[model samples]
Target: MQTVPMVKQKVHQTLDTLPPQGLKELSQFLDFLKYKYQAERRTNIVALGGIWQDIPFDVTDEEVRALRRRVTDTLLSKV
Candidate 1:
């Protein structure tokens, strides 16, 4: 199997053979791939700890059960 160093050497050799325009396009492509990779690696989490700090939602147990029931019904209906 090709090791990391071997692969890097091959890449460097290939880069050496590329024309100026080809090198520019390859650099841009590599940058785009890096950006895409970083974007996908991120988690979709937000710290909204105080997003509605002034608002009060005094929810009851019945409300929770009712919401769950409605959600389940909607899902089952779709299925």
Candidate 2:
């Protein structure tokens, strides 16, 4: 993949400056963005915020956290 110059810098800057509410809004916006474009997904996994490596769903936070823990445990066992 071709790297977009200044992409990381600008993304970090924007995320860092977001207030809590803005962060929530950004999260929702990202959720929509991912869903809208998912049919065109090329890779097996899609990354977000450089660090996150999965899709964020509309499920409750508790459910999401549980899933994350499961994925972490499974990945750790594999390595």
Candidate 3:
């Protein structure tokens, strides 16, 4: 595997050879990579914490399951 410095040098060399449009495309691709990486690192529990907090603590397992099914159905229907 290439070291970090080696990777940086290679990237710079490649960037130098790219035309203006290629550089723009590379910038967009880098942004997408960063967004995808950050999104993958986030946990579902962390994402839903605030959204689920309003639900009553006494809710039963069955209710949760039913809600999940309804949500899945609704989402699948859209697809």
Candidate topping lDDT = 1
lDDT of 2 by residue, 1-79 (tens): 5367678777888998899999999899989999979967766653466445455645799999999999999999999
lDDT of 1 by residue, 1-79 (tens): 9999999999999998999999999999999999999999999854445867666677799999999999999999999
TM-score of each: 0.56, 0.43, 0.55
RMSD in Å for all candidates: 7.3, 19.5, 7.8
Candidates 2 and 3 compared by lDDT, better number: 3
Model 2 clash tally? 0
Model 3 residue runs over 4 Å out of place are 46-79
Compute the lDDT of residue 68 as modeled in candidate 1.
100
lDDT of each residue in 4-77, candidate 3, tens digit only = 99999999999989999999999999999999999999887433367677765676999999999999999999
Question: How many clashes does each candidate structure show, in the order listed?
Answer: 0, 0, 0
